[model samples]
Structures are given as C-alpha cells and as structure tokens.
Target chain A: MLRALSVIVICGTAAMASSQSNPPNETRSSPATVVPQQQTPTKSTAIIGLDGVKEKTAGTLNVKDGKLCFVHSRNKSQISAAAIADVVTGEDSQRVIRGTLGTLSMFAPYESGRAISMLRSKIDILTIQYRDDDGGLHGVIFTMPVGAAEPIKQELITQGAHTTIQTAAVAARGKQ
Target chain B: MTNFFRITMCSCLFAMLSLAGPHLHAQRKDTEKIKASALKVEMIQSDQIAVPAAFQVAVYENLIQQLGKKASFLHVYRDGDRDAASIPNLVVLHTTVSRFKEGSEEMRQVTTVAGATSITIHCRFTSADGKLLLEKDVNGKVRFFGDNRKATYDFAKRASAVVSDKFSANGQS
Candidate 1:
C-alpha cells in the first residue's frame, strides 16, 4: 500500500513539471524574425519602478507616436523612446497562477501541498533604463506574457531606444 | 510487530528533528549581534566590469530597499545626501561588483539545471574616520528559479543578514 501511494505521488509530480516546462508562446526563433512590429498592446504586470502605476499593477503597454506608454485604469504615463538608454530583456518564473492557490495549498495534508506549491509558470522580463529631463537615471521593470518582451524590445529599438548589446557577433567578440 | 515499531520510532525521531531545526538556528543569531547607530549606503561601483545600466540601477535600488527593512541601523542614508554627513556615528557601506554572469531564464526553466545566474560583490563597512569595521565577499545567485534580477534581491538579503549579525542601531559596540 505504501509503495503504491509513493508511485502515485511521483507520477503526479512528474506530470505537473512536464506540463509547465515550456510556455507555449515562447519559441527559440532566429533574431531576425523576432523583430517584426507587434501592433496590439500587450498585457503586463509592472513589477517595479514604473513612474505612475503602483508596483505590481497590471497594465497594457504599447509604443505610440515615438514613445513607450503604460496605461493602468484611467491613468497613463510614458517615456519618449529617444530618452531610453538601455533595454534589457530577462527570463523569470513565479508560482503558477500568481501563487494564490499555491499559498492556500500549504494547508494540504501529507506534505503533498509542498510539491504542488513548487510548480511555477515561466515569465519574461523587460527592464528599461531611461534618463529624465535633468539627466537623472531611472529604470522600470515589467513582466509580460511569454514571448512578448523581444518584440516590444525590437519595436523600441526601431523607435530609437538603445541596448547594451549591439549584435550577437559583437557581443561574442567583446567576450573574447 | 517489531519492524512496525521501529518504523514508527524512526518517523517520530524525524518529526522531532524537523521541529528543532529553526529553534537551533535562532539561537545562533543571538550570539552574533553587534552595536551601531546609523548606516549610509554608497552607490554601487562597477569600474572593473561593464555591468548593464539596468543591472546597476537594480542592485542599487534593491540594496537600499533591503537595508531599510533591517534593524541594524536607526537611519539609512543614500549616496550624496547632505544629511548623512551630520550623523557622527554613521558607518558607510561600499559595494563593488567583483564578478557577474548573466543567465537565461528560459534555459533554466526548460532544462532545470543548465542556466544559473550568479554575482559576487565586495562589501566594506567603514567608520566616518575611514577605519574598516567589517568586510566580506558576498555572493547571490538564482540557480533553479526566478529572474536574473532576483540575484540582486538575493544578494541584498544576504548582505542585510551580514549587517544584522554584526551591527545594531540601539547601542554602541
């Protein structure tokens, strides 16, 4: 009976891990294809340091008229693309479904809740470095749906924003 | 019957050990406290390495946020604030990034073992008169989960732990 229960738990855990292993939207595509303009505004969570919105606020972001704009509720704020100093894209993960269910699952019996809570959903990060009018440096971070960051970055670059890494070959040469 | 009894005994022992783990950890912290008054965090220096601008800002902002939560200082001062100059008992914290490695979040999530981001910082605490108080090489990393920026948060937490273990705002050393 004990061995049977162990096998069941193991299989359940494996299933959960495999199911969320790769987010469906993100794919390993070549850089050239990653740069096409995405017209539709992307839904995102502002993690930290956006000017008007509170931290962790959910919002829609888009590039409009040479600016990157974030809108939450009735309030909106934007930074001109030319003022942006750097655009850095990163990868991250959080507990599945924003962690509320995971938090409640801690009360589950037999320590099985611990395994369930460990499951996570992959996320993409976009960190923007900009300078204000007086030349003071600032940064804002936003987490978006999988596969959303690169296109946004490409759009920003097309609109005159800068990135530290110019190209893959240039980055490799610098490393060497 | 004997085998059942042994298994039950082992389970109880395991339970007892798990319960005692946190209690023992707290006792160790009690012995590591030091006394101080105020702390000023200087801007992070990365002259040796070409850190990304966003990363530099992230590290600086996260450290300031974490230091405010620590009880080790009565006052936390930012870089270039005129107010910190007046605090006679202030200890200045200087941080320089010694090493950094950027890792892919996608690689880590897909493979679970391949991509891990790590950073090493040299932290120095000095008195107003320039005497070194405490210095250590602090490291932060995200091995299996989270963003590359989470490494900055991890570094901040560990550095705060070192400060809490060595300094206190309530009294003099």
Candidate 2:
C-alpha cells in the first residue's frame, strides 16, 4: 500500500507540473503577433513649427527634395510639396490661397466705395491673411475692390501705407 | 524512481510556461504598438505643377460660401488680372489634409511619404510692395472619409470665421 500511494503522489505531481508549464497555445502565439506590430509604421513624416503648438502623435512633417511634406492620419495620400508656396507665422498669420484677384475680391471687399475710388485712381494695396492646416499663416497682395485707388493709397500711406503682417503667434499675442 | 520522474516533468512544464508567457506579453505589446502608429496625422499635396482652373474656382466658391458674412471682400485675378470680385468681412486659408486609403502602406512601400499629408501653402496678406500684413497657417487633420478636398474646404471655412471675428474687432484700431 505504501508503494502504491507513493506512485500515485508522483503521478499527481507530474500532472500538476505539466499543466502549469505549458500555459496555452495562444500565449505562445504572442511572438508572432508582436513581430508584425513592431514592423508597422505609425505616423507620416511632416514638420510643423509655431508657438504654443504641441506635437501630436497623429501625423508627421518632413522636407523632401526641398519641399515640405505632411502625411495625414488616414488615407496617406501623396501631394506635391510645391502646393505649399510659403508658411506665414503670427497670431493672425494665414496661408494665402493661390487664386485670381477676382476670386479673392469676391470673398472680401477691398474697402468702402470711397476707399475703392481711391484705389482705382492709383495703386492701392490690399492685404489678405489666411491660415493653413498646419496652423501656419500667410498673406497676399491685391487691389481694392472699389474703384478708388488713389484715396485708398493715401489712406494706407497715412496709416503707415504698409501692411503689418503679423505671425499668428505674434498676432495671437496682440503684438502685431 | 517516481520522484525523479515527477521532478523532471515539473521542470519541463515550468520552462514551457516561462517561454509562452513572454510571447503572449510581446504579442500584446505589438498590437499596442500598431494601434499607436495608426493614430498619427500626415500631410500631402498634388503632384501636378499647374492645378486646373475649374478646381481653383470650385475651391474659391467653396471658401466664399463657408466664410458667409465674415469675408469683407473676395477677388480672383487670373495671371495678375482681375477675374472676379466680392466683398466679404473675413477670409480664411486652408491646406489639404488627407489620409491614406490603405493606412500607412504608401509610406511603407515607397519609404517616400512625399505628400501623404502636409501644409503646402503659406498664405499671407501684405501691401503691394510686400509689406507684412496678417497671416496664419491652415493646419488640420485627415480622417477616414471621402476625398480630402472637402476636408480642406471645411477647415478653410471654420478658420475664416475665426479670423473674421478677430479682424472686425481689430479694424476699429
């Protein structure tokens, strides 16, 4: 009886040890799962610069062949670097859309009729500010919508005549 | 004899468990990594040198509609000649934000994420002689949706509204 009991104990110990050691096939499959994840690229390469701006893990910024490039989080489309002509910075800084003066005039008038009359008479500079997706800003030059170029020029000249383009950061700080 | 057999079996089982444990952990880590990678933003643009006029018109129209009353005025000039004009209280600038249809596959394949996502234009408004005026970067994110053109438009619209408010207040100065 003593010998039989001893054998039974040994068998139980061996069974417990086996059960604890093997774990599950799923567990063994972890390495395979990990390898692929490690290989996947997370973000696109894009560069962005601005004040009070923090880098999010969504996309990336980079310069390719002297052109700035940014990849979106989802579809990963390829765009020409030249599409971005320039980057403007400041509080109210904006990206100027490349379009005709007529199109831009449609959205924002150069000034009141009086201002227009002056613009038509002489060269009147109209400044338009815009922003891009990367939180950068830009400005563009155009004529006043109204016909008065001279008076508008005079007014601008009196008002320092030069458009004070402020970076979005500076504009935001109310410095411009 | 039985004792020896039991000890050997226990050791082998323990070794197997140890190996499997790390593999499972590593798998979980890998999955987490992939999920993290998929959550980033990218920038992209068109390859064509000259964008079509129709496309440009559409973009301009879309921008005007979005700006509504904020656009003080809008004017389109073809090759430095005035083509169209409008008076809006505000203006907004935007950049194309796009996402890859196949996630980051393009980036992985070409290793050249080229215009996958980015800010292409630096919009600025200045005096005729290039005097600094007002400017901002039209930056945004791309999501899993239709073409990114709409996304860009939407961004422009929202940004324009914000800029209009600021301009109106500052114009008093």
Candidate 3:
C-alpha cells in the first residue's frame, strides 16, 4: 500500500510541475523579430494609465521587433520602445486583479493558468513613461504575470531602460 | 500520504483566497479619488488661416467639442460669460492659428488615397491675474483616409492632452 501511494504522489508532483510552465528556452532571451503566421503570439491585456490624464483605458501590451508595443481598439501611432524614456516596475501598485484571482481560488483550489500566479502575492506591473513625437511625456501601465517579468525586463534592458531590480542590484552584480 | 498532500495544498490555497477580498476592496477605493478644476476656453483664432471659410469654422467647432468631451476638470466654460472670469479662480485660454493646409489632390491621386491635411496652433493658459501657466505650440495631422478637417481633430486631441496634463483642481502646478 505504501509503495503504490508513493508512486501516485511522485506522478502527481511531476504532472503538476509540467503543467505550470514550459521550460525556458534560449528564445526567451531574444524574442523573434517576426511573428510567424501559424503560431499565435502570447499577449498581456492590461489597463493603461496615460500620464497627465485622470482616466484609464483598456489595451494590450505586445512585443514588436523586440520593443514593447502598446495598442488599443482605438488610438493611433502605437507607442514603442523608441518613444519610451523610462520603464518603472510598479513598486507600490495595489493590483486588484491578482487579488481577485486569489479570492476565487477559495472556491476553485485547482485553478491553474492565471490564478496560480496570484499565489506569489505580488502584482507585477510595468509602468512605462514615454515621450511622444511632440516631446510630451505620457505614462502607460501594464499588468503582466510574474512569469513574464524576466523576459520583459531583459527586453527593456536591451532598449536602455533599466528595470527596478537590475538598477538596484547593479552595484552588487556589476555589469549584466 | 497522497490524500494528505492534496488536503494540505487545498487548505492553504483556500485560506489565502479568503483573505484577498478585503485587500481588493481597499484597492478599488484608492483609485476613485479625483481632482477637479474650473477652466475657460477662449475663442479659437483663424485670422491668418488659408483654408475655406467653412473649414475654419469646422475646425474651430471641432476643437471646442474635443476639449469639452475628452478633458476632465471641475468645470469648463466658454469665453462669452463675463461673470465667469471675475470668479475667485478662473483660467483663461488664448489660442492663435499658426498654419493650415487643405487636403492635396496630387497626393490623393498619386501616393495616398487620403492625402495629407495638417494644422498648427499656439495656446496659452493663464490665471485670472493674467499670469501665464502654460504655453505650447500644438499641432495635428491626418495623412490617412479621413475628412480634411480631421487635421483639426488631430490638433484638438493633442491640445486637450496639454491642458489636462498640466493643471489640476487644487491650482497646483
């Protein structure tokens, strides 16, 4: 009885780990420049906060040519890294979406996908402050899963905006 | 042992989920607070505009509509009200049309289906004491398929952002 139970437990652990996320390949460090027709690109839909404005809008944060692209159903001149002057990971954002996901886990403990991320107790948000062609400063806010934080940080680093973590740890780690 | 592990994980997950309700409620309250302001929109000048007579009026009308619709503040008043300017706190706006170009038939026939239409304007926002708060040369363009006056729409859109972004309700810059 003990041996059969052990086998089941080991299998369950292996299956759970596999289901969480695929192994990070080298492509994560360098996302492809062109999106393939057959493959659907992963995306993060977020509530965008425009600087100097009191209201917020819904948009998707996408990666285009290794630079972040902010697009909505409406709006022109999609914002890209070239427009961004600073990238700040929100240090004190109260992301209610993650909290709401955690609350739902009470009824569905087996919730996977986006819910599992809320277990980390952190709402990972990327607050990008960019300048428009007119030299006006605008702010954009995006909510992303914690799993996507590293790749985004790396991408922004390539564009010259240092993530909060890397900027803080630069002294101890030297050059990255 | 397997059942015990499942029970332990489920219990932990459930407990954390239960605690999130109050936290989420607190966050909702934080974003609701907004500051309001009272602003005055003066006339949109078109003395030097080279466009058609209707085009100028259309552009002027469009700018007023956009500023009223998109900009968020305590109150927005048009210039004709004499009593409004004398109020304790009043911000007056002065605008001058700098440049304008009607849609080009050549570009529409040769390169773009819509051609290019553009407009530029200078704006100054001030307090009742005539103290200048903000001055900026705002412009807009419509190069794609759209109405020629969309250039003004574009200009108004950009100008509204300037107004909403620079000032706040408490009169603090």
Which candidate leads in DockQ?
A: 1
Q: Which ten residues in a row have the lowest lDDT in candidate 2 chain A?
A: A114-123
Instruction: Give every collision pair in model 3.
Output: B37-B74
Using Cα atoms, each model's DockQ against the true complex is 0.07, 0.01, 0.01
What TM-score does each of the candidates earn?
A: 0.60, 0.25, 0.37
Q: Which CAPRI level is candidate 2?
A: incorrect
On a 0 to 100 scale, what is the lDDT of residue A24 in model 1? 47
Residue A98, candidate 1: Cα error in Å is 3.5
Q: List the residue pairs that clash in candidate 1.
A: none
Q: What does candidate 3's lDDT look like per residue over A83-168, in tens digits? A: 66656553112223244554453344232222332222233456665555545334455555544544564466555554424443
Question: Per-prediction fnat values?
Answer: 0.06, 0.00, 0.00
Q: Candidate 3 regions off by >4 Å?
A: A1-176, B1-36, B105-110
Query: Number of clashes in model 2?
Result: 156
Instruction: Report the C-alpha displacement of residue B41, candidate 3, in angstroms.
Output: 1.6
Query: Against the hidden true structure, what lDDT does model 1 obtain?
Result: 0.76
For candidate 2, lDDT tens digit of each residue in A1-176? 65565565545544544444343343233211221111122232121121122222235333334232234544332223333332221111111222264234333322221111111111122322233444333233222212222222222223322333333433444554
User: Candidate 3 docking category?
Assistant: incorrect
Global lDDT of each model? 0.76, 0.33, 0.55
lDDT of 3 by residue, B13-126 (tens): 999888997888777664442233566666567777654433444445455557777776546665454546556567777887888776752244224455687778889888
Q: In candidate 1, what are the lDDT values of residues B90-114, reduced to their tens digit? A: 9889999999998865466546687
Docking class of 1: incorrect
